[model samples]
Target: MTAPLHHAGFFGFDVFGTVVDWRSGVARAARPFLQRYGIGVDPFAFADQWRALYQPAMEQVRTGARPWVRLDVLQRENLELLLARHGADVATLAEDELADLNRAWERLDPWPDAVAGLTRIRRRFPIGTVSNSHVAGMVQLARFGGLAWDAILGAEMAHDYKPQPQVYLKSADVAGVPPHRFVLVAAHNGDLRAARACGLRTVFVPRPLEHGPGQDTDLEAEDDWDLVAGDFLELADLLGCP
Candidate 1:
């Protein structure tokens, strides 16, 4: 890996699926249920369904049909669907058990390099997450991952989710940096595409395993992204010093 990059006025960073490995965490947490349900399922299927629920839920808020809800709320909502479809009675799930499951995002495992890489990068950038997560979820995830961000920006604060310029802009606003100065680094090409569409500089870090096993990774970065890295540390090097 190369030396870290520095951005004097950069604003927010992202949390899930970026700094940490969210799918692995979820799959690990839900394994017992997956076994108990006796449902013929693969780990990636659950992860994909969980992510698929995100956009539709956000569309409800974006279209103004449903009130703004945090990603955690949406995850729990979708989790209920997962359980029901797999034969678990929602009524039988205790509140504590459900809450623990909902907090799984907060407890995500970081990439092996995440903490060290973020620590090195934070010295030069005012890093933070521009996520659709609730403050509680983001904070807990940051705490768990040992991510040292200067701020945590969420779509919940904006009353909407990403793929919307507002969520991206909100992070810039919260971090007190202009959109151009902030670089969105992510594993999802779709998300990087959104940030690029909004005129923000972007870095693509591919997590081939975001979909779990037997899945193909997002190997290509759009030509327009500022840079693409094998990992966050390499991304840090690619950015270079001020």
Candidate 2:
């Protein structure tokens, strides 16, 4: 026999593609690099490549091919890869400009419903971001977007990136909640699948624009999540108001 689910406890969540608009931030960062130091390179393509490279970079850590590198190193690795792909180099840019680009994740705009959804969740449950993003970046984003988090949980915190069970399970410990009492809200299906594997409850909300146009997500709600919503508002509806 099973017990009724507790509605009030703790929640683990994904922030990069979940609460914040990573694509918009990335695109904005690309334009400046393209305009200035991109050196006639296809920066739109670079941004696209940069975004695409995220998972594989984290996967390197997850699979033990690389050590527990933070998201900043992974982003830098992807940045250098994109530069190499175009036969360009980073030496052309001032150190300041290069460092600024690394801060893009810090400036991600929150989704329309993120503030409201998180605020609502906070009334009842402790909420934290379980993402591959660096701690400093997520902290700056919270300040940038006015997001309220009970705690910050990330690859930087756990020292293990996502798709790894250690990273996901650590969310509950970081937020001081039992694993079963927490829910992971994420936009990416792969992310949600990982949380589901950890015996953490899950809610999926679509970030259709996370990759901009022509991006096809696994829109099919998997059997894993306890709830699937088109966006954060619908998630709130399913979870009920605090």
Candidate 3:
């Protein structure tokens, strides 16, 4: 029989769409850069375009086509490609401007339920981020979004990205919990599937608008995840929290 989620020693959350509203945050941060280049593109579309490159970039490392690279570096490299692809004059920007723009991932705002829900869950279990972001980026994001994480676990720590068995196994080790004693809570089914394969418990929280309007994927649990909740607060309630 499946044990109650609260019985798990800790929960590792997926930060991007699960905790923080990355689309809004990235769009907001990218606006000034677009304006500076006289680019009249829809910022949200631009955000989506930038995000589309996320997995492909990580796959290079997962497949060993590239050395382990920090997510920040991949993000910056993707940003350059996105700007040029979207017709923004990348050459017009100063180096400092580019650097500041690349830090957008560090300033995302948390979802309304994130801080309070995590706070409540923390009373019963240790909570930390298991994200694809770099460790430094995750720390800055937590501080910026008021997320209280007990530890920051990410690609940088494992020197690899998620869906990789090593990343999930290493995260369990870092959380000081047996694989089965840990839960990976994410809005992405692929992520949950990978964790499940590694013997970790799974919870699916749907972030329907994670990709903005016309979003279709991850709207519901694809597999029989241990728990499926509408949001973090509901998840806390299902796990027997007050």
RMSD of each: 2.9, 2.5, 1.4
Could you tell me which residue pairs clash in candidate 3? none
Whose lDDT is higher: candidate 2's or candidate 3's? 3
TM-scores for the candidates: 0.89, 0.91, 0.96
Per-residue lDDT for 84-108 in model 1, tens only?
8867788877777778877777888
- For residues 3-69, write the lDDT of model 2, one tens digit per residue: 2235537777788878987777776887777677545655456667788888888888878898887
- Candidate 1: segments with Cα more than 4 A from true spot: 1-8, 34-44
Query: How does each model score on lDDT?
Result: 0.74, 0.77, 0.90
Stretches of candidate 2 exceeding 4 Å from the true structure: 1-5, 41-44
Model 1 / residue 198 / CA error / Å: 2.5
Error of 1 at 99 (Å): 1.4
